[model samples]
Target: MTTTPGAADWRAANLANWDERVPIHTAGSFYDLPAFVAGRNTLRDFELSEVGDVAGKTLLHLQCHIGLDTLSWSRRGATVTGLDFSAVAVKAANGLAAQVDATTARFVTADVYDAVQALGGQRFDIVYTGFGALCWLGDIARWARTAAALVAEGGFLYLAEYHPVADLLGDDGATVENDYFHRDPIVVDAPGTYADASAPMAATVTVEWRHGIGDVVSALTAAGLRIEFLHEHDHSHFRLPAGKGIPQVYSLRAAKTA
Candidate 1:
């Protein structure tokens, strides 16, 4: 039987689910930790271009899993800090940093909503997030406020994520199967981690929320960030079905003018 959780109980369920998957993801081929430690960069090409030169700048990565992308920024000459809700993931990230000799990189364990306080009110020249992150967050407005608070003045927040439209498509990747503007909590009871589906897992129940493009832009605007650009792409980190393809990914850059 599938386990169902209440809307208010997403945090605990997700924490358990992610914590259980940490070891699996670490050892799986999907992340390819060996290749990563051998000088692979996990960041997407477009993300590198949009975020631009991070050299000599402070960059904070929210929901940074395992710190591959976080350490990739460090290799590019940025002073980097990564924060995640999963303690196991944070520990793995720290270990990866050591392996890569990323002396400038640090990892912290904290919920994204508590980022400001957990990081001791530290702000960064760039606040970066995305690649399946928005879906895990329940409130875009609250998230935007927190992200904006962490961005130093004249700095920016860059987000590169799977498009909400892809969530509406069925497995076939062409048929519309789910609501695009869904506001309720989505409870998913599945068998294994995305990295290793065959891997046994005890915590299968996870709660997710979908926020539209308008919702994200509006929230950031309300939080005092000026939208610089929003770009949509047909390519995605994960493969979609071979049939008709819609926009699979999107990126947005917002600057803290104040």
Candidate 2:
């Protein structure tokens, strides 16, 4: 089935796919839950540097799968709350927080679109997201609005994401395969999760959208956030072919000056 962008069924398909992957992810070596619970921080070095000194800050993490990053921020002294649509993931996150004794960490199960209301209109000092997150959203502008609304005055939104350019590259990493400008949903009906590709998965159909750097920047600005910086990097968590010098990942920091 060809899933179109903004289709309710597509969202449901994505959610089902994600929900089924929770257990697989938690068990797989990709996430390394054991190391994480043993105090290993999964956050990237650049994220740590860019976000800087989260101590005594309130942070809201959207689409935070299983709360690893959320708890990692909490360990850095931020009062952190993670939100995900997958209830199973949320439960696992809460469990992980308990195991780590992250007293300031909490997890909520809700779609990103309903984050503001789900959190009772509470704004945070830092709104954090990304790491393969933007592709899941059908509407980037709406996402920006939601993220902006959840940011308190003087706070900022930090996004660390896989570059959309990587999507354009084929398996060989040199050939142009996908369209970067494609705004519709890219449906992938396949087996296995990213964490464990060999592991069998029931919900195989998933939908994704592509949002270019320009799209993301414009959305945030239109939502009233000032772009602080847009940094592209060569390294990625995934195996992006080397020597190509293509941007594998990108980070953006947008602030609410008022």
TM-score of each: 0.95, 0.97
lDDT of 1 by residue, 86-107 (tens): 9999999999999999999999
Each candidate: what lDDT? 0.90, 0.91
RMSD of each: 1.9, 1.4
lDDT of 2 at 44: 90
The TM-score between candidate 1 and the true structure equals: 0.95
Best candidate (score: lDDT): 2
As a whole number from 0 to 100, the lDDT of residue 1 in candidate 1 is 21
Model 1 clashing-pair count: 0
